[model samples]
Target: MTAVRFKPTLLAALMAASLFQSAWAVEPFVLKDIRVEGLQRADAGTVFASLPFRVGDTYTDDKGSAGLRALFATGLFKDVRIQVDGNVVVVVVEERPVISRVEFVGTKEFDKDVLVKALKDIGIGEGQPFDRALADRAEQELKRQYLTRSLYGVEVITTITPTERNRVNVTFTVTEGEVTKIKSIRITGNQAFSESTLISQMDLTKGGWLTWYTKSDQYARAKLNADLETIKAYYLNRGYLEFKIESAQVVISPDKQDISIAISVSEGPRYVVTGVRLEGEYLGKEEEFRKLVTIEPGEAYRADAVAATTKAFTDRFAAFGYAFARVDFRPELDRAKGQAVAVLVAQPQRRVYVRRVNVAGNSRTRDEVIRREFRQFEAAWYDGQKIKLSRDRVDRLGYFKAVDIETVEVPGTADQVDLTITVEEKPTGNLMLGAGFSSAEKFTLTASVKQDNVFGTGNYLGIDLNTSKYNRTIVVSTVDPYFTDDGVSRSYDLYYRTSRPLNTQGGDYKIVTPGGAVRFGVPFTEFDTVFFGAGVEQTSIKGDTGLPVSYRLYRDTFGETSLSVPLTVGWSRDARDSLIAPTRGRYQRLNLELGVAGDTRYLRGDYQFQQFIPLSNRFTLGLNTEVGYGKGLSGKPYPVFKNFYGGGLGTVRGFEQNSLGPLDIEGSYVGGNRRVNVNAELYVPFPGAGNDRTLRLFGYMDAGNVWGEKDSMSFSDVRASVGVGISWVSPVGPLKLSYGKPFRYQDQDKIQRLQFQIGTAF
Candidate 1:
């Protein structure tokens, strides 16, 4: 048996061989035959394919050296030699060992498939060549991954074991120690602002209760860089034009379980904007371009305003098909006077048109569903605003987790580009089963099945079932957004509900209602819609035992069972920035229902308004007002079942559910025909969660009152309450928990100060 030793410096050896060829004169000969040896896994044909010479071809020092270089470059062999025995060329090679298997031991930080993928990405995996260099690279990659997770004390050991048939097995053993957390973060040289104020602008923070989820305490280079940028922006936005981060240092403790960060910054003199001038090409729209400038004279110099002005200019140019436009802001600063003048320069390059539009990354949703949302068309002039609106519209659909648009230049065409829209689809179907405990409902159970994109056709289907002590309901619904192909929507709903007294021990007295409705929504504007619906409802009362006086009287007058045909008209307008956590927007709704001809005749209407104002990046102020009124028509009394109920989660939080308004002879609540409610709330990020909006804390003041048929609605009789609440948008659903205290309450009024509800937002 013979052992082969492959030199590490193969390129150097090949260079030396080239030098020998030039130094010595060797005779060339014609090869009679070619033979390959020392191949266990790789075939001889592979070697022949890589060779520079063949049988009957002239073989010289140049060809021999070229063949060796080619074979070695293939990365399949460790050694190669060419010899001639009486005009017969012979090739001998030592093939590299193949990786038979890859395994990981003691890997808890990441899954085995993840580690294998990481190794495979760097060309070190099963069925690949085994080399020390590749193994070293794999080890370094693994270590880098661990560092990203703040595991400073992690260790990786690679073991290569030889197997039969010139194969080897690779294993990576990982020891993931305690994750190092930031113990303290200190900022120095911040003279203009307090240390606490400056630190509050940073994302990195000390270890706290929320650190486990936010990971702000973890040390990451990327996070540190982002925090530094945020600090700089904060200063620049507050008129500190020359603020700079001098240095940042991170120190790890001896035990590798704790880390500390220190950052030094210099705040220069504050400056006020003296003036803003627009220069360069404006496409003959100087006034329009000037109006886009947000920087005002005699105002504080704000980097954000300057950036906004430049972005506006670029966007305007893009609207005119100038996709390659550039806008630059030149600031002339006078340090002595503490003043600056900003000059905007714009350059509109060649006009380009879109050559094509491509969509990708949508596995469930149909391509037409996404394409219809796009406002930017192919073979048309580029419009940046339209493209951005299209992106936002697609995102608002809520069918995808992420939506991104990219512009790519078309090859060989200077005035043409291609737009690519990429979307990451999310699960649009959900099956939920919920259980909760409340004082009013006691033990409640709920189940729902919904699909927002049924069969990828952009249709919605849902079924809901609720079984509570006070209320039981079952409903099924479906919607089609493109019923008329012009943004018109159609929906149908069928529901059955049974209601009983909340404080009653048994279901003695109950009201049963069954109904179905068909509605159509017509979009008159981008943000407004008008809906019209018609429904038929049947209401029946059963088991007069323990029934309220009002319920019993209504049953006797209406003959126990009643039928009605209702015509409903509604209008809504929404301009929220985000549907889940709106920071700035206004929403308005108006609804009217008329019972034309039935066992009971009634007219009811409601109007609601909501406005959200952003106080800062982490705070928002919200105001909501709702008013309702109802009466009977055609000389008949108002239907008892159509009365409005106030109090509880969606109304006054300090009062018991349905405990407001007129009372029956038995002292039970009989609801009312008129209702008014107003709510004001200030929302802030949850403590220790930084700027995460998924969870928030809010302080709210609520005032509302329900008036009976004869009672007039008055503000003086409205009940008021103040409370604090926590809102968390968890993966399963949204949850609200509040603790309230009534400011005005009587001994006869029922009180429920603590309230919580799941699957709803405050």
Candidate 2:
């Protein structure tokens, strides 16, 4: 059979005789069978799906033209045409080359995977059809992404290489130029403040010694906008009632390596606040709402005060089940008198009930783990306070990196709402096996497997084994957070340990203690947990050559191998925003221990408190204090093994571990029965990281000491030091490194100015 090509010229000649459906010089005929050609990657089904005419149907030139247009519109083919032979129709298509791979060269600022994801979002990736237009779009998108990082001179060149099997490999070669730095920042229309002072209030700066770390010299549009907002807030807080940012202009230099920014602002006259008027329905608590007003009656107008008042009023209304409450601040101006009256109006909308509480974005975690933490229940009146509390509880669980509660209105219900809790899960455990060498421990092997959320259950399990010259240990632990329906927690610990400290110089003595414990945690309040536990242990003094005088004294008083049973009672409350890198919160712990029946009889108590205060977006203040006391029960003296040890990372800086306290005749730290410690630190954001809370720098002052049972506790006996440190919330865990300098210390004090540890800050 010979293929017949329907030429457009012949169709035009036929068009002169017939029109519309009968045009294009082709006589309509009943089609027999249709065939698709030139298909390599895409199947024949793709071509058949877009054809306008089917087999066994009357075919005309119009249907043939429409079918050709539909095939081209699919974007799967580069070319398409139709032909006829006898009563059969044929469709020919040139399929667009599929992308075999996407690669990048000379790109460093972002990972290759990030760029690949970006291109995939725009429908350009492996296995997708490729063409010139799509490649051009991908190039522009890469360039735009670089511009956000202040790389204005970045260039992207796409290279398409043909491969076998009708596919092409796309390579995006990126040439990232030098970052455009802010050469200068000029502020205009400042009447009451100097330009330098206003610039100091902003995060963006014109290059400084610290700018290399802060990257404040980099010119970013979003950063400039944020600076402008900061400047506006500065003015508004200082009584400039009509302050505004008129314009912000950013100019790039010819070389594209320097940028200049000019910000224009308008600051109006300062007005004094005359009085505050509250006009709102406060659910019969008008006086309470009035008390929330922070606007001073006679001071200069403060925009922050007015905002605080409105927010407080709104929150108070929400606490009363008014989910749609609104508070508006309307200032009554008196231009002539240079005085203004602050007026706050509140509206308590219809009280709504929570129809349902739903959790989303948690594919692995069980729903009960989150639901048990929620205080807001379904079918209850909407209380913003309860909902907020529920959100905080979930956040404190540390299972989710982000927790947000959204209030959504129920359709067709005037007074019904639903609470949606959205969460982003995080890896809650680690599996590690490694070897390390230290001067004290020599060569050691360590292995640990810890899982906080096992199989989507909110339970914790951990196993640890360490083989060190100084200390060898093996421990297995587990915790059931919800052992009972009432949120009671149960935990078990099994461990074996052997330690030999200060035994490096042919000293063979070591304290061998192996013990097991079971504990239960009972929640007394939302933020408070009371823990009680019991443990049985045997202490054996081994190797008689180099035992410390204190250890020998305890062994001589009791047998070399003595048994002890201890009971523990504890209470803790933690309200930290983040367990790894908290900027603001309060934590408290109280513990008491007593040896009920044993060769050693003693009672010990300890209390610790920590507080973190956020000074600003880039700074925080942390304070901590701890105290300990112990006494002998019955006629026995305080057990030397149970004495308090201090002067370490957890106690005082700039001193050797457990080096503070009464010294034995052997010139070793014997520890004490009483201890006190205090710490103060100022945390700052890391350079170039913006306001990231995970990495930070800090300056601290520490003071503490331990006193023996025979000595009295005195402030003069405390040792103190000042130091600077860096803290990073790394993927493995929280790490802190510090270098301290002791200002006041005894001649015998063992100084260790530098130290590093992995643990919580407080």
Candidate 3:
């Protein structure tokens, strides 16, 4: 493999003339054959492809240099040389060594694979050709990742080790320092508000009791910018029309363990609104536009009100097919007199229709499932209100983690737009196992396999089994939300439950109920639905051990087993912004049950009302009230098993589960025919959580009671309790934990101060 090197007589442009070294310069000649040497991993074809002059073609010194330059430019070789023989051309190359492995050390804050991925993104990873420049860049990138978590003094050192097969291994050694905290924040040029008040408006805090969980002390550029925006809004909303942030500076301590921020602002004189006047075309609906204005003549100038007015105006235009309407406003200020006039301008642009609606990111969901919830149709005039409603309806389905819709203009079209709905699907199937303990039930185990979205058809299927000392249940249920395609839903349920009221004086008597039901939900409106159902049930008193007097008497009079046919009628309406964490809205439900045929005849009805009021950005007040009543019908006594039980998580917080109402003569806690529960809660944002609504702390007050058929309903008998709790929208479900203290109690009353459950705060 010995080759003779020849000096180039002619060099290509920008290439060294002395690139090829030999005793004498060689002249160009026609090539008969070409040979390549010193290729390890690369193929010989790669060297041939880089050659400017091929074999059997007229070869020249310029071509030889150009071929060498091209091979070097390919980055596959560290060194390239051309040697000339009598009539043959020889090319030699030294290929760069490839990367064999990538490793990370001392990375406690990040996973090893995450660091590997970061390195791969920066052109430095396993199997890649090793480059010193890229290796240095990877180190800086590693440092940047650490800085995001407030590790100001973090250090990254890269070490390269040569391995076999002409490859090298890269390893990054990181030393993540202690997290830095924001020690102090100073604000200048503030006359209307105190420094503490302005600081409280920001998410970033110096520190707090929940610092570990909330992590608000961590410094981030984006978070700081958002905090600044919040401050500006606060000033603008308070009539500081000329407010501006001059400068912001962040300084780190010498030890890098603390940081300080200084902000400078200009709070000009407060301005009072003189009037709001419309100046542009109102589409002959000027009077309607005037009614939409929220600005008061004597009130302070507020940026939020102005924004709301403009958005409302734009929406009004969009309602009339003007999707591209423009609405903007400016304030004319009299600085000396602190007076301002808001002049709003509007322009209704060309009307457009939605060309098509496209859905994306629904890998496990059917297209019809999303399209069915859309109020806005394809090829329809772009209606902003309808579009917003459609998005909200899809979100309420709970099948996707996020549902986003964007309108994009169609190219080469004068009046057309496309709606792109992007969704992130979440797992709607779960096999849940739950366990609880109570004095009456002793111990209970509940297990269920439910799929809210079955096979992408938006159907629901569930199987449930429960085991408890006093009660056991086995059930199967399913629902087809679009059974008739007109937004009507159908549901079927079959269940077998064995119930036994526990008492020390009574024997272990039990009643087994086997039943099935079919229900249909008709959509009365966008937010209201009415439900109707019918079911047949057979009840058998199995144990003679020690049944309650009421149950024994009923069984004796109606025979050992009684068959009942029940009819149900219900209605529901929900206007909450979110079911998981509602900030403001109202919900109402009413249900009635009638046993019109069979051995048992009775009537039962219940009504529930809930309202959530947003007191501010950080607080919300929730009020809930429920009332129920049941009585005998057709001269038949009410069913004992149909009675309502109170004093639990869903009723009163400070009492034991199902411990309310009139007790049977056997001293067992038998439920009454009338039930009432009232609850009020004040939700407070978690300290340092930074506007996260999913997790919050709350204070609650509960008052309610149940009464037997012979007892009179009275507010004096109501039991009240006050408590503090925490609610969170966790991955598995919505969880609430509360610790309550009862303000009223009797000798026989059972008090449970602490409770935890999955579902709504109520």
Q: Which candidate is the best by TM-score?
A: 1
Candidate 2 lDDT over residue span 1-762, tens digit each: 998875433443344224433433468999999998899979898788888888889998778877766776678877666777888887877788999999999999998898999999888999999977788889989998898888999999999999999999999999998988889999999989999879877888887666666687887788888888888888888788888898898889999999999999889788899888878777889888888888998898888888888888877888888999999888888888878889888889789999999999998899999999998889988888888899988987888999999999999989999999999999999998876543224567889999999888999999999987757899999999999989999999988888765422347787788998889999998878899999998888887786788888888888788888889999988877777777899989999999888887899999999999999767999999999999988888887777788876878988887789998777766688999999998999776555656778999999999999889888778899999998888665677888899887999788989877653343
Per-model TM against the reference: 0.91, 0.88, 0.89
Candidate 2 residue 554 Cα shift, in angstroms, is 1.2
Residue pairs clashing in model 3 are: none
Candidate with the greatest lDDT versus the true structure: 1
Residue-level lDDT for 304 in candidate 1: 96
Candidate 3 Cα lDDT to native: 0.86
Error of 3 at 78 (Å): 3.7
| Model 2, residue 657: C-alpha shift (Å) | 3.2
Location of the lowest summed lDDT over 10 successive residues in candidate 3: 6-15
**Displacement of the residue 30 alpha carbon in candidate 2, Å:** 4.6
Model 3: number of clashes?
Answer: 0
Q: Which stretches of candidate 2 lie over 4 Å from their true place?
A: 1-31, 56-66, 83-88, 336-338, 432-447, 464-474, 499-506, 577-583, 613-620, 682-700, 721-747, 751-762
Q: List, in order, the clash count of every candidate structure.
A: 0, 3, 0
Residue range 180-290, candidate 1, lDDT tens digits: 999999999988899888778877889999888888899999999999999999999989999999999999999999999999999999999999988888889999889
